[model samples]
Target: MRIYLPATVTELGDPDGLVARVVHAVTPALRAALPDEDEEGLEFAAQLLAADDSLDLLGERPDAPLRRVVVAADVPQEAVAPLADDDAAPSAVRLLTAVPWSDVACAHVDEVAAAEDVTAALAGDEDAADRLADRDLLWFDVGELARLAAGHE
Candidate 1:
């Protein structure tokens, strides 16, 4: 199954390392919640949810750059389970084990120009957060992750 993992630039230090457990994927609940959306739409919705969660990750690593990162990867279906938290997003899930970097397919990340809004959003600015939600993240191949983490385009 494919999943979207919330992350930060600095967290990509090792392109072949393990990622956190939390991820977002199209679950049955997400399908039920957005019954009218096509598969592509649902997937995009999950990615957006992951992007929002990325903000929380950024808050945890103050030394990390202020940019949202969503790692899209293909993992075994058995590797993930729906999150137990009732308050979690419809697409939220928990990985039963660590996800290896090799499983990652690509990444969607905020461009450098989005850093200002990302900074304010992390500081609890609602408008800044809204602006971030409206922005489109740039796509990067799995091979570019190391360079991205190094603060290069």
Candidate 2:
């Protein structure tokens, strides 16, 4: 199953340092919620949900740069468990094991220009959050993560 893991750039400084337990994926609940959407659309919805959750992760890591990162990985079917309806968003799932770097396909991240908006959004600025919601995160190949994590993006 392909899962979207909320993350921080600092974590990506080392492939082995990127850690995530709760992830977003195309769950049965998500399918039910967007019955008419295509597979790509469904995956995008899950990725957006993961992006939203990434903001919360940023809140906990003040030392990390102000940015949003979502790692896209292909994990085994047995690795994920969809959360109960009342537990989380429809796309949310719990990972049963750590994902090795080899499983990661790529990442979606906020551009450096989005830092001010990300900072504002983290400070509870609704308009800034709305702007972030409308912004498209830049795609990065797994190989470029080390450079990105080094703040060279």
Candidate 3:
């Protein structure tokens, strides 16, 4: 159950704090989304910690435009599939699994990207929005995210 936790780092605030907030926001979402699971929370937390370690190892700048935390564990595969389908708002955070894209097969991903682009453009960052539009990047799989998410009590 590899999970891809995509996050954005903006110039408005602290990157590390933002990451922590994202983690806090996501933990409960994951738990609610997978009610049958008991240890998912701990596993996800550990995976996030490992992701932080990897980032430190790579000497990644905290201010990078986009930062992703990969979490792997044995949680339910369905728990993370909806992230690719999120398209409601710019600040909408998503958690997705590494399963094939054909599973959800909706315009969710495109819609989300479009919304983000529009938001960026409206904020006078058309260049950034354009860059986002031109690319077909889909953040997938958090390496061992699923495995890590399922290992906790």
Candidate 4:
């Protein structure tokens, strides 16, 4: 299955060995939520999942205004499993297998311009969340993950 996992540079690795995790998007639940939507719409829903995850990241690190980081990966269906979290978003799932760095194919992050709005959204401003939602996450090649993650590492 191809899942988009919301990640941080620190999770990507700092001192060399950190297994990326699965607060990933694009899961069965998300598909179920919008059965009639096209693939593009589905992908957008996954991005929304990532947006929510980014707020989670803010909760963990109150000072970070960095854009949300989402890494797109391809792992076997068996590798991506459900987590026991009734409170979690429908797209939320667990990654049962370790994601080899090679499995990460691309990334989605906030545009630099979205930083201030993201900060406001992180602070619980609902309107800011809407504004932030309007901003698309920028894409980059997988190789740039290191440099990108390094910012927080």
Candidate 5:
């Protein structure tokens, strides 16, 4: 199963993929939420949820750099299971095991150019936060995640 894992840049290639993330799918709930939504919309919604999960992770780990990170990983379908009921959201699932680096297809992270803005947003600047939200995550090939995790600038 292809899943989106929220993460920090430093954790990009780590074997442990458990973090504040929601492994999402086109569940009946999601369909009900947007009856007209197509496959592309559902995928985008999952990505957005992954981004939101990254924010939750940042909140829990204040020492982490201020940036959004989401890893697109492919694991065995059997390795995943549906999450329990949550009226707030029903499209989420859980990964029952750790995700090795080899399963990662790519990573989406804040661009170096947006780091300053992200920092400012993290400091509680509403305008900066809004602007930073407008910025999109930059995609990096999975092979590059190791380099990034190795303290590359």
Candidate 6:
């Protein structure tokens, strides 16, 4: 169940805080969407967050407002595909808004990469274990992402 959560950067105040908050916000949504999810699913989500640095890929676009939070879980690829599909379940990646905790504006990214990076990161985090596991979600603050994209110039 690889899931990519694209949230308004405002929800994430700083880079370090991004990961945890993202996890908190996305987990419940995912759980609600797939209530039957097990421990393996949770671990997979956590692994994805720890592995990839979403800030690096978005680039340094000054006008870009939101920070993208990427999450991945180990589920059948078929199950995840429809969620990521452009035409189906458009709201699969639940959106959170007007969060006072965030310091940035908007977060955006390529849905495919978000999903791939999250899955790869999670898989690597688990050391490519075969067993299904639950893990924390990955979060990248938009402020930090923008800064990183700007090369801290």
Instruction: Give all candidate RMSDs, comma-separated.
Output: 1.1, 1.2, 14.7, 2.8, 2.7, 11.8
Model 2 Cα lDDT, one tens digit per residue, 30-134: 999999999999999999999999999999999998889999999899988767659699999998888777899999999888989999999999999999999
Sliding window of 10 residues with minimal summed lDDT for model 3: 102-111
Cα TM-score per model? 0.96, 0.95, 0.23, 0.83, 0.80, 0.25
lDDT of each: 0.90, 0.90, 0.34, 0.71, 0.73, 0.36
lDDT of 4 by residue, 70-148 (tens): 7777778887678788887788788776677777788778776777887788788999889887877888787776776
Most TM-score-accurate candidate: 1
lDDT of 4 at 5: 76
Give residue 85's error in model 1 in angstroms: 0.6
Question: Ten consecutive residues with minimal summed lDDT in candidate 5?
Answer: 13-22
The positional error of residue 73 in candidate 5, measured at the CA in angstroms, is 1.1
Off by over 4 Å in 5: 13-22, 85-88, 116-129
Question: Which lDDT value does model 1 have at 27?
Answer: 94
| CA displacement after TM-score superposition, residue 152 of candidate 5 (Å) | 2.0
For residues 1-153, could you state the per-residue lDDT of candidate 3 as single tens digits?
Answer: 433232332211222221222111234445565567567554444344433333332234434333223322233544432323343222123333232322211110121334455345445685854654454433333332223224310
Ordered from best to worst TM-score, the candidate numbers read 1, 2, 4, 5, 6, 3
User: Candidate 6 lDDT, tens digit per residue, 65-136?
Assistant: 323344332233333222234442322432232222243333333322244443443446444222212332
- What are the clashing pairs of model 4? 9-149
Number of residue pairs clashing in candidate 6, backbone atoms closer than 3 angstroms, sequence gap of 3 or more or interchain? 20
lDDT of 4 at 32: 90
Better of 5 and 6 by lDDT: 5
Q: After superposition, how far is residue 118 of candidate 2 from its true place, in Å?
A: 1.0
lDDT of 4: 0.71
Roughly what TM-score does model 2 have, to 2 decimal places? 0.95
lDDT comparison, 2 vs 5, better candidate: 2
